[model samples]
Target: MRWSALLNPGFLVAFVVLTVSAIGMSAAIRAYGLHLQKLEIHAPGNRQLSALPRETPSWKQIGTDQIMDEDTVKTLGTENYVSRVYIQKNPPAGQEPIALEFHAAYYTGGIDTVPHVPERCMVGGGWLQTKGAQTLALEDVDTSTWIVDAAASGGARGEVYSVRTLPAPYSDAPGTRVRLPFGVAPDKPIHMRISAFGDPKTGKTLYSGYFFIANGGTAASAEQVRTLAFNLTSDYAYYLKVQFSSAGVSSAQELAELSSSLLGELIAEIMRCVPDWTLVESGEYPPDNPRRRTGASN
Candidate 1:
């Protein structure tokens, strides 16, 4: 008696409504999945590695000539659409290791990993601040005042300042921050000495300096610089220091090249010691003097 009654017009209407609702929900879910896929891997594009001219310093006199058999470095992208940079140092050195800090961009897909944030990774009070995509400003947390020599010779003599601007980590944040961890806590202020000198005429040296920046009181500093110097060697590494006032490392495209001199000396030493070791993407290296285990990563 109920079979025919169950097949009423009302039942058909309810069935059609439920079916449509299910189809709509499925479509919405598929659309969201596609959106997330888009964020997972950014489109492959021109991810320039070194913005400035590069010099391949010789490590012949250094012991690296004997210990290192294969010396090569390649970077790639990893993590939430970010590049994870790594160096595979093989053959190995005994006590003295060779290291070099090869400059790179974070989002470049060619590398397996890159620094979490090249501009924000503070080492010795260095971080990058940005007003927008074009204005990549350097903020100094180091106590040392560094001078800037804008004019650099070589192919980079005319290169202008370029930056990859990023937004704040959180939507509600006040401003964006770039971090390159040098393990200097907010409690202690990092100290450094800085000076710049470059002769575009001879093209021997573009710039040079030593400086320091320490944390004021927090685990981090409010003022940071958009700069970093990575030690090429695995041991006793010192990063090139810069100040917030040291804006426009160059009026031309000489940021990487001009700063290369400062970094070149430091990196050359590392490579001399550890020929097999490649540059790390973490952008973190041990202080020339070894730190305690717990404090190493700091």
Candidate 2:
């Protein structure tokens, strides 16, 4: 009688429903496990990551500056980040002054992990974003231009010890660095035109441009970053936010162009110092890589 009651159609149906529901819930929890482990997310040490070179032939690095105070860093809620403010001077007369602020942070929380972006930070600092955000891609760059003469002069005989020894550009000439016109593509990087209204009587029009790179993917909009943030396949997450401002630009268009060129050059130099996403993702440092040690360009 008890066996018959257990095997009744209604009881069997109810048991099946409960079993399926339990299995579905367990799968859902496993799929969204990253969300549960967000609080435990921690980035590797800043020293473990790659760094920018202090000097380049076209641009001389004056010195490094801090992007934020301790208070600000704490407010951002990540200690595994690096901030570098570089004052660089272009040669010929060293007159073209360029200032770059590069801040890279690792966060494993939801898409809203990064609280500071150009839109929020600029407005909070009393600057107004006049132009809508746009995308810019730094592609097909003539990488030969990045290779310094010193490395090229050594020829292919000896092992080059400098990180400044850039990968050969796609050209017929193998050893020589080629000079080409810097071109801008319309994609990827997020750029915004910003202005500040000081005392109305003496208002100042300052220009600002910024972008964010998540893992290795570039996002031109905050929405894009948020959408890309939920990657359960990867164990860790990282983002790089680069911001710079130039004063006395004639127009937002001019500022955008200049910002693109400067940032492209800076990024090229930076790549030499930082490890690739593959290495970072695996949390494994390459052995005998000069860039990993001393953070020097060479």
Candidate 3:
């Protein structure tokens, strides 16, 4: 604490050198961190909206994936999206066919977001809200397949093969199933919002259900989108906008129960559309695996 000690030339020079060195080290570390980001670059694949799977186990894609209008795409803020529908190829017993629609968008590295939901769009377009926002339970639908993409093995460019990997749904005894609605997986729960509206014009129940799987988890509601998409701990983020509708679905539970098959097969394909979080966290950016899904080993 002495004034003479503070004025000591040797101590003063050492203190100054240490302070400057710390500041320079900090800047260099920041630059190196930025450089590390550049190293984690993913080579693009068939992630384009058009590349969405055309068929699943029980459903056939109605047609090609639709392209959104320019204004709608601009409003959503990203073009990495797919707007498509699939029709049940073989409805059970006497049940009518089910048609499910899907729209998914992926965005990364930004905090800015815009609010867009089915309710808002429907009401503005003269639709009435028949049912309030509800958490529809998505039961487990076990669907798996083997994907042999020629691109992955550096063989022919367009030779992709498929093989059945796992047993079909309902293969297990009724005693083994969960009592509650399990979204994507048993260990990994996901959020799905199903809202019913009165299509007073068509007199048919308008069912729209959606959920989000971003980074490494899922969000059921819109409020979680911003937080999940732009967290401080990670540099990559993505969200899914899944909407399914059917005139024959009389109730929310029925819609959810029946959707198990279609969504079961479709969810894995959706994962391919987003960046792989496992690799992102480890700072490794390899080409995407077309066959990868939540529980698949290969």
Candidate 4:
């Protein structure tokens, strides 16, 4: 009776279906798993991902970019990042000098995991998520003349490294470090993500703006980044987050829109430190490629 039941046509058909389903599932897992693919960590010639430009014709960097301890770095999951404030020089009367708080972080390789965006961190840190994250479509930034990188100079291992290695009036051909530097051009439109937080204690509102560049595309939120960073098609993956913080701004979107010119210029310096996605998509610039191209990252 047991053998006859096992050999029944319905039972045999069900067993075959289960067997085929399992085999197909295994094949799909093998093909699409992120762990099965190669991982890459990219940086500028200076080897410090935080070595961005310090000065431009309009603004100058001031204040220390927090000196992170071991625990902080570990919590961040990657040492390659920047968090600095650039104070605008000599503002017009009745207007406060603009303080552009800038930040960038890159994650790849074994450090691969969920990205940490400010919306979550700030709210958890005692700020209210006054407004949900919003996407601000910005005018295109031209880079035909900018992004000409000289060989990387400094090799600082931590956050103590200054944004600039030389004196003012930034030289395109300085004998010193030239990590990331660029000017504004309106051609390549980019998207920015922004969220606002209110500090109950101070009764003040602060805004955090950012965008994610993963693989060869860009996203406005952590949820979107997850999809872009782990898509089945890409063999290598990384997420470069460029963020800005501002206080006294009415809204995060306004802050981003009002500061578009400044942010556009700042992005030029920031992109130099980011990996050129064109080559990454082409499998030309792997982590070990050694040939650095500060190519288009819009």
Q: Give Cα-based local distance difference scores for all models.
A: 0.26, 0.47, 0.59, 0.63
Q: State which candidate has the highest lDDT.
A: 4
Show where candidate 1 strays beyond 4 Å.
1-22, 28-101, 105-115, 123-252, 256-298
Tens-digit lDDT track of model 2 for 1-298: 5888998999999999999999998899766543333222332233322244444434434445455678987887766555654455552374556554445554554545754666677666766666665444434333334432233233322221122233334212233322111111222233443333232334665555555555445555556655544454444444555555555465556556555554545454433323344343334444432334535221
Give candidate 4 regions above 4 Å deviation: 1-38, 44-46, 110-112, 140-188, 287-298
Task: Provide the RMSD of all predictions against the true structure, rounded to 1 decimal.
Answer: 22.0, 10.6, 11.1, 8.6
Residue-level lDDT of model 3, residues 1-298, one tens digit each, is 6889978999999999999999998798665432222222221463654555576557778877887799988987877777887888888889778777766666654455544678888788788889998886676554334344332322222222322322244222111211111123343334468888887787767777777765555677777766665554444445556666665677877767666677676655555556554455444444332213222221
Give the lDDT of residue 100 in candidate 4: 79
Q: How would you order the candidates by lDDT, starting with the best? A: 4, 3, 2, 1
What TM-score would each prediction reach against the true structure? Answer: 0.20, 0.58, 0.66, 0.70
**How does candidate 4 fare on TM-score?**
0.70
Best by TM-score: 4
> Candidate 1 at 19: error in angstroms?
8.8
- Sort order, TM-score high to low: 4, 3, 2, 1
Which lDDT tens digits does candidate 1 get at residues 1-298? 7898768999889989999999998798655432111111111132222212122222111122111123222322221111111121331356332222233222211211223222333222233222221222122222122222223111312221111112222112212221222332223323322223333344332222223221101111112221222211222221122221123343312333333333322221211222111112121222222323323322
Model 2: number of clashes?
3
Residue 277 in candidate 4, Cα distance off native in Å? 2.0
